[model samples]
Target chain A: MKQGAVDAVIRGLKAAGVSVVCYLPDSLFKELYPALDADPDIRTIPVTNEGEGAAICGGVFLSGKRAALVMENSGLRASIEPLARMGLGAGIPVIMLMSYRGDLGENNWWAIPHGITMEPLLNAMRIPYRVVRKEDEIETAIHDAYEWAYAAYYHVAIALSGEIVR
Target chain B: MNRFDCMEVLSAQLKDELVILSLGGSVDEWYNAAPHMRKASLFQQQLGCVTPQAFGLAVGLPHRRIVSLDTDGGMLFNLGILATLGNEQPENLFVVVWDNECYQSIGGPPTHTAAQRVDIAAIARGSGVKEAHVATDLATFEEHCRKGLAAREPYIVVAKVTSTVRRDIRRKHSDGREDKYIFVRHVEETENIVIMGPSEHN
Candidate 1:
């Protein structure tokens, strides 16, 4: 499930024609970064923070390009400002790939509160999201997320779990 | 060096071509005091990204001057931008680091910026800015700034300013996002916005 989830996410991004990705080095998505970095088809911008990454994606979108940001759920908190202010204001779509940190028998106690609050926070921001519990749902989630992004002109996040942890 | 006086010189010299990326807090005084100065962007204290963002603007536009008006406190957040700027080698960038020895934007909190003892200009010299200068006050600052711009190099000018914040001056005038969009659009719509060159550097 480990490499499988990675492959599915990469395939989904390629299928959607995502050309650039913004990321802040996160342990959860370490495996995916190098692959995308080396791929000549895509441009990867390593940002200092999640909010900056999100804002850069907004910029990429305004320039008429497709973009996605990879981050752990903790990165979600830092992104709220840019997500709400610019992304929502300009009707830019963002595909957020998040690693579920503190959910379903997770050990890290500190990540628990944020993990619990993540979905609700997205709801509060009115940014649509989905949880992809299995590798099979990856493509559908990404495709639907892109559609939602275009229709709503807002951010759409997908959480990978069960299979991701493997 | 008089901060206001140096700003006046810079404004008179480079206002036509460059947009300074200002930081939040007390540095607003120099920017606000000199309305004659050229237009600038992203003045809010978003910390550390302004330089890179300016570099990004420089790359995308490739036809305008991109100046980052940074505070030491803010610059410390992501110094890596220096290496990246040098690596990318965008010729249009001018990073002006205002080191007043405190986080004057947020109630003058001490932000061990550059370790106080470290000569930030020397650090910039080592960081590949290619042309970095440290000016103690307005006169020297104005002089160095002119030379840096005149040399046609990616420059870093570290101004050692006095720790001063005008309570009346606003900390932030534009939301970071709005500035980004407007400036980005400004670069895009106009193919050639840089009106002046090193010849005009005061």
Candidate 2:
């Protein structure tokens, strides 16, 4: 039996000592929401929007706890304000795990804009990111994002694309 | 009563509880009212984010009480946070929205709360915040603050106040970034946990 993507993501989050997660569900990661909610060690908060999730993550950071914001790549746009003010302005870091919605070979025509604007927007914010395509690489990407994010006191993102999100 | 009077009453009822002030006016008010309270920090003008940030603090540090002095304009920026708050319902969080009904810091443009009669308390209740209340007077606002802060349930108080804000008060901290450091340090000391990672300063 193959290891599930959700399990892999959970393992990575645990390894990074992430106790809290603020998420806004998207179709790409709908299954992950239930798993995150059920996990005893992880506190999952369902936010109304990605901006709320980002701010919540910032608040968690202020409490001396590790929190991650998990959302769709399109949500990166929604969260830019909080991310910019909190991370860029105030030096509070928020680690994000986003699902790559409009990646290559995507079937939905509407999702293309999400992909088209994703990398550029992230770059404009000066947020370092990695698009992880392999299931085996999920945990490393998550762990790496946290390590550097905390060290630099800056926002970092790992987008699950390729087969992982597909 | 005046916004400062409400803040003074709120300032009088403080101990180790964490305070998160909204962008401009509330931050200045909190600082002037309680200058040495490092546990209280100013989150820069990220309207629509302050209440959710307080919600995060409440949920994350369940042992500590989190109070957010959010503003009407700030709440209107992202009213969706009320629904999230009502849904998550962290018991330790107490929110007080100072409803001056306008953008007081930015030259007094009327917000929906002023023009369209946007009842934030009603909206909060509709969104599932059972403990939401509106305080048009200082006595009611103080009562809500005094009791709401002590309650073990999630609470919200929409304090309708005047648009008058004092500009003479100076910031205790140099900038939001400095205040952020102070806030993190206070939590690290009081909570006996290390929050800041290996940065250049560390």
lDDT of 1 at A123: 91
Please give, for residues B1-202, the per-residue lDDT of candidate 2 as tens digits.
Answer: 6888888898888888898878767777777887656555655667887888888888879999898888888888888888987777788988999898888888888889997567999999999899999998888888999888988777999998988888788755567688788788888888888888455655
Q: What is the TM-score of chain A in candidate 1?
A: 0.93
- C-alpha positional error of residue A117 in candidate 2 after TM-score superposition, expressed in Å: 0.5
Q: Per-residue lDDT tens digits of candidate 1, residues A38-59?
A: 8887777776678767755754
Ten-residue segment with the worst summed lDDT in candidate 1 chain B? Answer: B193-202
- Candidate 2: residue B38 Cα off by (Å): 3.8
How much does candidate 2 score in TM-score? 0.96
- TM-score, each model? 0.69, 0.96
Full-model lDDT, candidate 1: 0.67
lDDT of 2: 0.86
TM-score of chain B of each: 0.78, 0.93
Residue pairs that clash (backbone atoms under 3 angstroms), model 2: none
DockQ for every model, please: 0.09, 0.79
